[model samples]
Target: MEPQLLHGVADSVATVVIHHPAKRNAMTAGMWRALPPLLDVLAADPGVRALVLTGEGGTFCAGADISSLQGSPDEAQRLAQRAEEALAAFPKPTLAAVRGHCVGGGAQLAAACDLRFAEEGALFGVTPAKLGLVYPAAATRRLVTLVGPATAKYLLFSGELIDTPRALRTGLVDEVLPEGELGKRVAEFTRVLVSRSQLTQAAAKEFADGRTDRDAHWADQARGSGDPAEGVTAFLQRRGPRFTWTVPGPGSA
Candidate 1:
């Protein structure tokens, strides 16, 4: 069966599932091509507060489907990079709920997400070295940002799988849960994110992702949104803040 990227939304969280059980959810070129548009749709939805990327059949993605590598190699690489950039640039919080193997491009995708929650038995690796291919510079930089240069080199040079504990220690993963608890824990965390102010989250995500220099527009947004005042009032009143700031589009308010 062909690999697929499946998506759905519930309770303000969009779940994107990589499905290819036969190849351990390996991503095909077509799957890579499909991701950016799907992410665009989800990101444009004001009701969707967050996104979760995972794999079906109890396994996360294994990497690019090697068989497809024999054809349209450049297109595949380009699409894969586009997909990764889309995920990284997504305005809302994004999480990777990982299980089993997350290697090579799969590891790259997870690294693009804001947070990673892994099952205890999950394995991670960055394997371009094993394939005699160069890892993309942008992806390499993202990996370095997540796990530092030394650790990124360790994964890139060795192409060896690391367990969840090492992943957590290296900051590759935010949390590790037992086999049956990952979903519940991720859902709980997403609920907390949903309840928070989207304006604050968006600003923080942008600044945290290496946007060191702030522009005048950022300050304008903070003042215009009124989220800070609402947050403070809600805190004093011991209630949840009703944040009504929707994502701004091209010229829409």
Candidate 2:
């Protein structure tokens, strides 16, 4: 079957699935181009609290479809990079629920997500070296930030596949689950994310991604949103905090 990017929302969590099982869900050029617009739609929807990126047929993505690599590769790589940047900058929480092979460009997409959860038997690799290609600078930097310079070098230089345990040990993956449990675990975690204050999560995501200078507006937002007051009152009243702070769409000040 032709490759496709399939998406749906349930319980406020949007799941984006890469579907191309015949090639282990390798991403086609069209799929790469389709991603940014889809993410924009989800990002602008206030009801979509989080996103989960996964692959169909028991595999995550194997990488860019090699058949499309025969000609000029610039446009394909550019589209892939654009999609990766969109996922990285998504205003709300995003998780990559990975299984099976996640290599090359597939690894890039997973690394772009805010969190990664992998099944026990999954494998990961950054294989630009094997293909005699240069990995994108932004993606390399993101990998370095997640696993540090040494591990990043190890993956980029050798182009070797690492299993789930080693991936988790190197901090490449946030969690490793049994084969059958990844979906349940990811769903549960996103539920926790959905119930939290959006203001807090968005600010924390920015800081964790290396924003050192505090925007004066974050402080003003905290006070004006009443989240702090509601949280404190709910704690004292022995009730769950009803947080209603919605993240403003991109470019809203």
Candidate 3:
């Protein structure tokens, strides 16, 4: 069967499953190609306030299917980069529900999300060094931004897969739950996110994303704009903040 990008919506959240269990949910070229548009639809849908990415079976994603890369490294690399771009550039809050092995491209995928939840015993690594492959620029930046340059370099250069606790210590995964509780934990987390204001979440994500960069435009926009004022006012007045500002188009910002 062809690899699938299964999608569904729950409450105000959409879930994207990378379903390729035979190979531990390793991503295929076609599946990678299909991602951005799938994400675009969710982003444009008013009902979707958040999105979750997970893998079929017990495994999250094992990165690219190396066997599929035989004579098409260039094509494979381009497709992978495009997929990473899609996840990284997605406007709404994105979460990666990780389990089992997350290596190479899979790590890249999880790192692209705004939040990452890994199950106990989950393992993470950037294996490009072992494969003698150069990590994609965008993916590399995401890793650096997540755990800082030193830790990122340590993972990338060593090609050593770290356990869930170590990964958590290094900020690789935000939350690590018991293996069996991944789905329930993710559901609870998603529900919490869905209940909150979409505008505040979006602004918070935007501000966090730009925190490492020198430009403070995002900070200025969030503080100087009327959104925070409205949020505070709503809080004091015992109402919800009506946030109307959305980060441009799906892939624009």
Tens-place lDDT digits, model 3, residues 1-253: 6788999998988999999888998888778888988988888888888899999888889989888665667778888888888888777889999989998888988999999999999989898888778888878888988888998999999999999988888888899998699899988988887766565676667668774562465566566557777778989999866765554554454
lDDT of 1 by residue, 51-133 (tens): 99999978899999978655666666777789999999888999999999999889989999999999999999999889787
Q: TM-scores, in order shown?
A: 0.96, 0.97, 0.86
As for candidate 2, its clashing pairs are none
Task: Give per-residue lDDT, candidate 2, residue 155.
Answer: 97
Poorly placed runs, candidate 3 (over 4 Å): 211-234, 237-253
Global Cα RMSD, each model? 1.5, 1.2, 3.1
Model 1 lowest lDDT segment of ten = 244-253
- Expressed as tens digits, the lDDT of each residue in 1-253 for candidate 2 is 6789999999999999999998899998888888999999999999999999999978999999978655577777787899999999998999999999999889999999999999999999999899787889999999999999999999999999999999999999999999799989998999999999999999999999888887787898998999999999999999999998899987897
Candidate 2's TM-score: 0.97
Q: In candidate 2, what residue range of length 10 has the lowest lDDT sum?
A: 68-77
Q: Candidate 3's C-alpha lDDT?
A: 0.84
Largest lDDT belongs to which candidate?
Answer: 2
Q: By descending TM-score, how would the candidates be arranged?
A: 2, 1, 3
lDDT of each: 0.90, 0.92, 0.84
